[model samples]
Target: MSFTLAIVGRPNVGKSTLFNRLVGKRLALVDDQPGVTRDLREGEARLGDLRFTVIDTAGLEEATDDSLPGRMRRLTERAVDMADICLFLIDARVGVTPSDEVFADILRKRAAHVILAANKAEGAAADAGVLEAYGLGLGEPIRLSAEHGEGLNDLYAQLAPLADEFEARAARDAPETDVEVGEDGDEGALPAFSDKRPLQVAVVGRPNAGKSTLINRILGEDRLLTGPEAGITRDAISIRTAWDGVPMRIFDTAGMRKRAKVQDKVEKLSVADGLRAVKFAEVVVVLLDAAIPFESQDLRIADLAEREGRAVVVAVNKWDVEEHKQEKLRALREAFERLLPQLRGAPLVTVSAKTGRGLDRLHAAILRAHEVWNRRVPTAALNRWLAGMLEQHPPPAPQGRRIKLRYMTQVKTRPPAFVVMCSHPDKMPDSYVRYLVNGLREDFDMPGTPIRLTLRGQGDKNPWKGRRKSQPSALRKHLKKGT
Candidate 1:
């Protein structure tokens, strides 16, 4: 039996610290600054013998307008509604503030089960604040030091009974197992996850390119924080959801800027985290602002994806606002070919992340790109193609001798790496290698995906090259002479 717990509180109340403690990871970015987190980050948490889902929400704020803080507050309220339990946190050193009391009133009316916690309670100075928490009318506050790992036992004691109760209610509500639908319009099988493993796709671009907005539209909910803020996302938050029945784990990364411009320490960490996500991802979507498409930083990011051997997809966002679509798209294509020749022939999808338009096409392009990335070629087909290519445009014969490509075979996939057994491998020119790579891409339908082609000599090491006859040969000669 499983249940979800949401950690909620005002800014810098140690909610993220406790979340990390519960999930046993520093998944959420934490800093001394207030309101570092602005999204609903969920993880599987284990406390003692109990295991369940936990959500780390943005700090409760007093904003009610359509500002960033207000949006963050709305997102947190959604988490409280979705979670089975809410761990309301307070700063024991500072006691409860007006914002805390206001949110407490809200959570009392909304949350099904609330557990008040007085965090940062390790020293005696926090005792008065902990005592002052009793006036909030939620319940007795548990003294906790999330950084030092204190008060977890008390937290566990509070959660065990609730866990058992949830398990009981789930058992009661569970449908019967011996039922099946005939051919009529009756009930169907229970919902289950797709049999395929979730495809990992990372969305990366410069700031304010609508990466998080696109993800939220696909999720059909406001799962990520978004506003006019360019860098609302501070961490590479990965959300697993099925898009049109295909399971996927999508990462919403922080907007990347030029290295020289990124001076803030926390932004540096956030960018680093996003870069890590790009490396872990199989397909990377390089989003572009339609108005300012293909800037230097955008090209750098796409080139980074190609160099990392990730399948690349270029998505031009904000198409709804573009005035001359045809002209702009043609210019974008020409620029893409002129600048990013490595990712030539990749699918360039035009989407409006705000209106949720062209998402179906985007989905198809991603799946197709992934398919091309993981494509494998048979040795026979590769050798046949190699023979044709060699015949049409032979290798450059440097000096007097010709470089012979004796054999070719695919060594691996996931970016489709290949090795060619050839004589004078070290003498092959870069231009010739590029020719062969271009031929492979054109002939094998592997356009836009990174292709690794290696040249190797067949005789780098021979067993009998420098060795004399064994002692057994001398022994045989001596025996014959004696005979």
Candidate 2:
């Protein structure tokens, strides 16, 4: 296992910012509001030549067992236990508070290696607090500015030795293995990574859509906080596990309500965070209540996922409670086909998040959708299909000149994108593009996934094709001669 480092501190001390800097991506959302990060997020971190797994944890707090802050504290404690070292942060401008002291005591008792950091300590106003951090009893404080990229070298100096020691110990304990060589006898060549990346699925829908309940049913545990409350989930929490041997990462996002109704600042942040999760996900499962299926908001959510170029699976929740199963299923399918024709062939599975009914079907549908999304077609077959499409319903000619399509090729996949070399790209109507896209979907068994068909014309910019160019304007030629 790689060396692990966990960042733990009270709320709004720039812990998330430091996490982003180390991971070189903004995976964790950061804001001025306290308690913004409510879950632990892990990523590979790099500083100079050092590489380790860095986990960004929710800010620690002292609260009773049942409250939200208390739950977050418990989760952060789990992260501390999982790490090889802990970096406890304190805001230099504010100095140490009672909460910081309480957390320090806990980390001292629990963590094997503790590194203290005084953040936001760049200016003269923070001088006193920087000195105050020395009394935390962890060690000498590393005066760091996570946002401005300062004091990382000092922090690296402390981490380098620990990383080296960990590597040495691990190497000594590793089992002996034989190295395989290719026919060319390449020396010391490491084996290629054969394991595929886990498929990332994001579950999203309107408020109280049973998204969390469905995830719990799949995981067979109450890994998420689910209640009758509408907005209990505030952050996009990702859980990694295997579903029947298929490695997967599932994201449970906060329910998204319409913009006009979102008045609270926290809810607004929650919704934006959910949208980011959708963008990052490979397949998005739009869960809906069976009784109120195809609501305007539900349709909008599914449409957003489609537009984002993600594989979509429509899952109807609370199916166990429905009285008329056959009628409800038929009606839901018809409404889905009529309302979201763009995703015609996408999988629609019904499940009861509360009872776990139809979960096997849901799992199969997700795997199938993922497969179609990653499918590719050869260039020769694509051109042959294009010819058949043109023969059946030829493109329109706006000014008595028929548009000629010469070639077609699949440029990329993951919601397959294609480019067709045509006579006039700009003149191709939206209806025609839709016709081609639908044809691709029907002909290639690529239903329900987003398909992109772009028209490109040959580089000949001359407007007058197959016509003799008018002799260079006689007046222009005479003017050039005179000049």
Candidate 3:
């Protein structure tokens, strides 16, 4: 029932600013620099009482060839075709440039419904520019200031009627359903199938690792702009789809470089955004280049996912071009074990993001990793396993005092965490904790998933806890003696 509104303009015309204002969040990255947004980002927008879907697109460029800017232009044109309305924003401060006129012509032909907005029209300085915007012949330009939050009521007024029309069309096309509502407005007989929330997966790696290309293969469409350019994607773009019959919301994040090498402000923001995506993701696919597998940055990315307690699956991309596949895969497995001992048994899949080979195996690996990450062991089994491990290799006694582990229990899953009630929890060494963690992984078939082991020192119960102690007074003793 909702309509899609795409904001198209030349670079730095306040398109992303207006998008952030409408979405009520900084979903799209904004900067004074042009072309900061390279991919289309979608968000649910709310203005006044009207609601619709808003798309923040890359700046419309004049290039029509296979260059990066040309690819960006093609992607924006696709958005124009998909959107129900196109809100053309022009900089009131810079007035209408030649590029703006060109893009206006394109939108006039491509966009079904077009609304002209002269953004940053805050004061008298923007009045002449606003007047110039009318020469494009789209319509009367709405004088707007996205940064200052002015003229939004006019934007709302312009969109409300279009929203109504879309809703009317949706109602007319909607299929009829005969259903009964029970008390509290609940449906009495719902469908047998229940909707499950899609799994959240994020693909992250160093620059030019084919992260976007892999996701495009999964999506079966050119949903994101991809090229030989190292860092085309600037934001963590998430798309929802069904892959291998499993519903998933997959995030294609910007490539992360080392801290010392990153000097640009926009790249810094991009790296931070990718890190945030990893945190929100339940499963992280660490994509690596087949030609240069297990670089320092790749290891860092995988370790980061592990340290964040996310399910990790290592994938070597661009495998189709490899000549000695078996030798490379063997060396890859060896290096994975030697470098990332923490992620020892994790699934390492060889995939070709370009040719789309080995995707089925990658999907199976991801599901397996997720299952292992969420695997939980019962308390009885855990305690029994702990007893056996302790008997086999007892806890070290520091300074001739023996350490005692009384009980063990799994406190939580999702990178399954456990607690051990013991004596001298602080005295327990990291080596011992690793021992127990490795033991749990092996005994419980929880391979490659990060495990958290916590030791709590158990003390003797204090019977006098929470009770006030009364002392016998000397005066009371003397009175008793006199009596």
Which predicted model would earn the best lDDT?
1
User: How high a TM-score does candidate 1 get?
Assistant: 0.93
Better of 2 and 3 by TM-score: 3
Candidate 1: regions farther than 4 A off: 179-196, 460-463, 469-483
Residues 71-153 of candidate 3 have per-residue lDDT tens digits of 99999999999999999999998999998889888888888899999999998999899999999999999989999899999
The residue-by-residue lDDT of candidate 2 on 1-483, one tens digit each, is 369999999999999999999999877778888887876778889999999999888888898486777777887888999899999999999999998999999999999999999999999999999999988898899999999999999999999999998999999999999998668875666432113568899999998999988888888876676667677777787888787667888999989998899998878888988999999999999999998999999999999999999999999999989999999889998999999999998999999999888999999999889889998999999999989999999999989989999999999998899999988889889999999998889999998999988889887866788898678888999999999
Quote the lDDT for 430 in model 1: 95
Q: How well does candidate 2 score on lDDT at residue 468? A: 84
Question: Against the true structure, candidate 3 has what lDDT?
Answer: 0.92
**Candidate 3 residue spans exceeding 4 A from truth:** 177-196, 462-483
Weakest 10 consecutive residues of candidate 3 by summed lDDT: 186-195
State the lDDT at 297 in candidate 2. Answer: 95
Q: lDDT per residue, candidate 1, 1-483, as tens digits?
A: 989999999889888898899999988888888888888888889999999999999989889889998899999999999999999999999988887889899999999999999999999999998998998899989999999999999999999999999999999999988877667663566343353568899999999999999999999988899988899998899999989988899999999999999999889989998999999999999999998999999999999999999999999999999998999989989999999999988999999999999899999999999999999999999899999989999998889899999999998998999999999999999999999999988988988999999999998567787888767678799999999
For every model shown, the clashing-pair count is 0, 2, 0
